[model samples]
Target: MPKRTATMLGCAVLLGMLMGESRAQTDDPSGSPGAGRATVWIEPSVSVGATLSSNGNASSSNGRSELMLDVTPALRAVLNTARVKGFVDYSLRAEYFLDGNSGNRLSNRLNASATVEAWDQRAFVDVSGSISDQSVSAFGPQNLTGLADVNRSETSSFRVSPYIRGTLGGLVDYQVRYALQTLNTDTSIRSDSTSQVLSARLGSRPVGQQLGWFFDASAQENDYVIGRDTRSDIARAGVIVSVSPQLNVTLSAGVETNDTITLQRESYNITGLGFDWRPSLQTSLSVSVEKRYFGTGYNASLEHRTGRTIWRYSASRSASDSPTQAGSVRLGTNYEIVDALFAQSIPDPILRAQAVLQFLANFNIPADAQNFQDFLSSSATLNQTQRLSVALNGIRGVITFNVSRGTTSRLDSLTTLGDDFDSNTEIDQQSWGVSYGHRLTPLTSFNAAYIDQKSSGSSGISSKRQSVSLGLSTRLAPRTSGSVQLQFGRFNNTAGSYNDAAISGRITHRF
Candidate 1:
């Protein structure tokens, strides 16, 4: 670590400890009495580890063995109160190349979310930001997007949304929202963008066995710093019909207009139908379909909780400047969500253990995006993405399998999946992977995964890849743990084929 970084980090540790100690002696239940009105809590930890790599640079003929040392420190803070609840997770990683095939490298990642309440609680603000690096290949060690090529770049994004939602009276409810999103990159390999969205809705919420009507209007503008810009507007009116306690139907009609050529700057009519169904307390499903001048688009999501297994599924077709969220994608907090859900479903120890097993074994790469490998382009596109995933947990162990497929085209290529891909074109890709894990003993466990990915680029070339990994983890101490891992992969394309393998071990101590 740099001298300045070390000095600043030391100060942070001291401050956090002092604050924590002082607050513990304070009289207030919310915080330390003498700490005044500080609502933010911080926890930081440091970790150092060493690894032996068979191929550190992930090359073919030039593979070399070496010993690597790495230092990683992280900080996490949480805020929970009547008005706000959120957290920030940040980490700094520094790696040293002892064999010197590669130079020393250091990188950091930060993810944070903050929500604020205002206007006497009628209005609220949501803020999120991230800075991270990603490999060009969507499935690389750093590229979980699973949709790109073989390169690495740093991407950062920030978003701020503020909205007011409240009922005007028992007869009507209203909401107004505005959002600003900015994307930045440290390198010139990608472009920057700023997006603004403004929307409003006036509706009569469905209650009991009643009919409700709603009016909606929204506008969005996207500016690509190095490319063309887009402007879009939408207006709609809809009605909800409640057929029963477990079912509701919505019908809507609208007009859409945009100045972005990708979506055809033309004006189009929008017709849509959406439904929410809850047949039982254990299952829920929602689906929406719409017809527009550009094409047909749909979004659907289903979730079910059962005694032996948990399930989640979602599919969507829409327009997006980028397929992933916040320019980088990671699997959402699915495991944690499942844990929380099953926590309420039953108290059976077996089921609880199964849930825990599933969480530990099936932890996945964030699939918020299509796992796309495409370079970040400034152009917008109307594309389709489908994802299906399931996990089973039991005494046998935990196993998870899922596949994400995407068909992308430029705004102008919406008519068909393209045969040629370029910095400005379209492609089709299917990526899938599976992971399994089971505890071998009380304090040790083993896990393994296999992934097969295929993609058809605009260049009319196809590439396929397969990767496999196995690892074992165990607790080393009260605040320390260790793991050993082995990974192997094969890649074949028009260029040639290559195989690479690596094995490494690391121990992390938290303080």
Candidate 2:
């Protein structure tokens, strides 16, 4: 189907279904902050400052005296209704040369997310995207290390997913989902690509059942606009057995086939074992192990919550072609999860009652929003990823800590063409960070953080970096706020070392 037609058809179906259902408003905003009195809102801010570097531009062989002006203007908007939610965060930064004009430039960035519920809650649509200027990778661990170049790059990416799920005549449960994601870079357009996945599943009603049966099928296509294209098909049937109230085990078998860009088409049998355990309200563990054509792999996550603390951990190993986009396809015959865990949205019992039922109904939460924050640790690579994090909340202060580690042996075929990629791409990376936010008063706050990062590239050059930041923010008026921050970053390389320090501030007004 043509892209335009498919989108229109999906929108039409969603609208038609919503037209037939009664309108209702959900009470909670799901922790999303927004304006309460208006459907449309915008907040804008401006900042100007200076950055001093002992060795500017990260050049080690020779030192140069350079100081740059940082001028930034930013805006945020939120739109909320009974059945829809949307937001946009945007900023523009223009650097001026205090000593010279040769290296001054302007940068812009925007991030947005939106969701529309239709069909009386039976169908829904989700859209999200980001265009940002960053001197580091999107992945958390990789971001900790300083980039070889301090100049920020402009990267843009987006995803559109629509889904409909419910039961027919209250007997047969069914779900249909489709998604498309694409990413592009100003530095490497050849890495850009569009990925699409479509899927459907059917199962018997899951209410009050110890054992349930299900069947799932899906198809995925990855078209690298500048590199290669690939497609996949999957189909599977499985049974989930609830051995006890707190524990459940699932056993299943399926088939998967992949037609890759440079590799031969391959088909393989897939077998898997999955377990879900909820020892109590504060704890949950989920583990899945599967046998793949190349090897055996597993993905596991554990979460625990105490009065003032929440902890999360996840580990996964997957062997597949490098992925262009980061998201999940419907589960069918394939047992390998790829980067699905990072892209999915896990379900939360506190958010919706029926959400938990959806899990038992189909025995799979394909797009769970509650998945561990894997995106912070895992990149769009073929590798093993592991992450652990903890957040603590107190009466006057909050603290968050996380660690991420990952390793990969090869770069994606799309990245092989550029000499820069060959020179800077990493084979191993490990990073950790800790942040603290304290409320000095009801309307004012103080924040501080420290980050340490290290990485080694395939080219054999190793580097370590460390950074620390402190800031204070307070309300200036009824609809206004202001902040000032100071930061220091140091980079140590095999050949030499460099350091940077900066002071910046901003004031924002909301309306």
Candidate 3:
């Protein structure tokens, strides 16, 4: 598909069906004639599948036996109004081979977001976008299915922000923001970027003050279509010490300037400390530390809850220049860490994102596979991450587990021609996964999963992957559904070792 991407996806589906039928025939200035207070939700689906492979073209030498054909169309939507909020999920797939020796494909997936409240509660606007099928070489060739096309690629991202916040008579607290971000790929194998940021803040008023104060400033720029252009700035000030009533603390200092690793412009000195603790109501903790100029940075998190479980932990280190968030350079999943552990039991963000997509569709889970795997970088990097996850949710069963580790390096040494930190100065990764479903009744359901990944580079290059899946899903009427699956995968590197096995089936219909 490319006749200008199918005419720009048919003019964005006819401009989103004429702006959703002109916003459902607009009207509703607080109601009356055609009283509308817009609300729209739509679900559309279509799927057809077939797959039988031993190595359908992800060939690692004389591997053949292909039978693939799959078609998919999907959409999920939500929009609510009074001042708008929106969400969308989209999909598209087409694959066909039937032994024509592999090749005939198209893929797409998207996640979208929107928010607008133009002047209510102090002006706002935010937008988001995503598309995926990454890995343009983090040591190339790795797969776990999307039906083969190994060494992946198809990345997209977008973001927009506009902001203003108020409170100056409630004794100081203010905000100002601006953001723009972008990333794209259709293959140039990485390098396409744009980022801009402007920020402001002034604070005080930590619930009837106990010694509070704040000041913050920001500036950032990253522009690359082929590298070179990075700038950063920061300013700070702080104090907020309520050391009790469940704790609070902070202290900060300022100054920063950058060029992201030389070619002039370097200035530093910034210090920080942060804290917050919640002692109960199911536990919480937060932490922060900073002493920048690439040396010491930190952010920490912990959350706990039980009565059917949810536990999470996090750790971080900064400076990852844009790919529009998500552990920068795209990372974060297990369905956004169990939808942020169901935010204190679904505190409505559209019903906690539809109860985390019906709890990952009753655990046939693979909302982008238990996290961490993103590659394609163009300068500006420095990260260190850690994760731990757990989820339970029972009755008819659900379980999940996760583990993670990360490291990356290169904060630009002035465009070291063509990515991967110009021959790995650093790169290390690790991942883990486990899943189970079980609800063999109420219209079937039983699933299983296992995952693993490993990577290393410091110019010694390395790679590894493993996957296993089992599935069964039912409900064959009332807008139909069906599924069947068996899969296996393995990959290794130092340049060799590959394995695969598969069986698949699908049927879906909905409107």
How far in Å is the alpha carbon of 43 misplaced in model 2? 4.9
- State each model's C-alpha RMSD to the native: 6.9, 9.2, 21.5
| Predicted model with the maximum TM-score | 1
> How do all models score by TM-score?
0.81, 0.74, 0.34
- CA lDDT scores, all candidates in order: 0.64, 0.59, 0.75
**True lDDT of residue 27, candidate 2:** 34
Per-residue lDDT of candidate 1, residues 196-259 (tens digit): 7889999986676468889999888877655566788999999998888898999999999886
Residue 377, candidate 1: Cα error in Å is 2.8
Which scores better on lDDT, 1 or 2? Answer: 1
Candidate 2 local lDDT, 85-173, one digit each (tens): 65555678888767662367777665556667766978978766666544333221211212224434565566678899999898889
User: Local error of candidate 1 at 123, Å?
Assistant: 1.4
| Cα shift from native, residue 291, model 2 (Å) | 2.0
Return the TM-score for candidate 3, rounded to 2 decimals. 0.34
Compared with the true structure, what per-residue lDDT tens digits does model 3 show for residues 1-511? 2322432343354336434643563446577766743455566788898888787666677677778888989887666555656666778988887788767878888776666666877987666667777888777766445555667788877666678999998889899988766777878857877677898999986785678989989898877777787788889998988878888899999999987888788999999998999999888899999999988999998988877788888999997865553413222366676776677777656567667766666555656564567687876788899988888878888788888899988877656657677888889999888888888888889898888988899889898888888999787886677888898998878888778888888887877
lDDT of 2: 0.59
Clash pairs, model 2 backbone: 17-119, 18-119, 345-368, 345-369, 346-368, 346-369, 346-370
lDDT for model 1 comes to 0.64
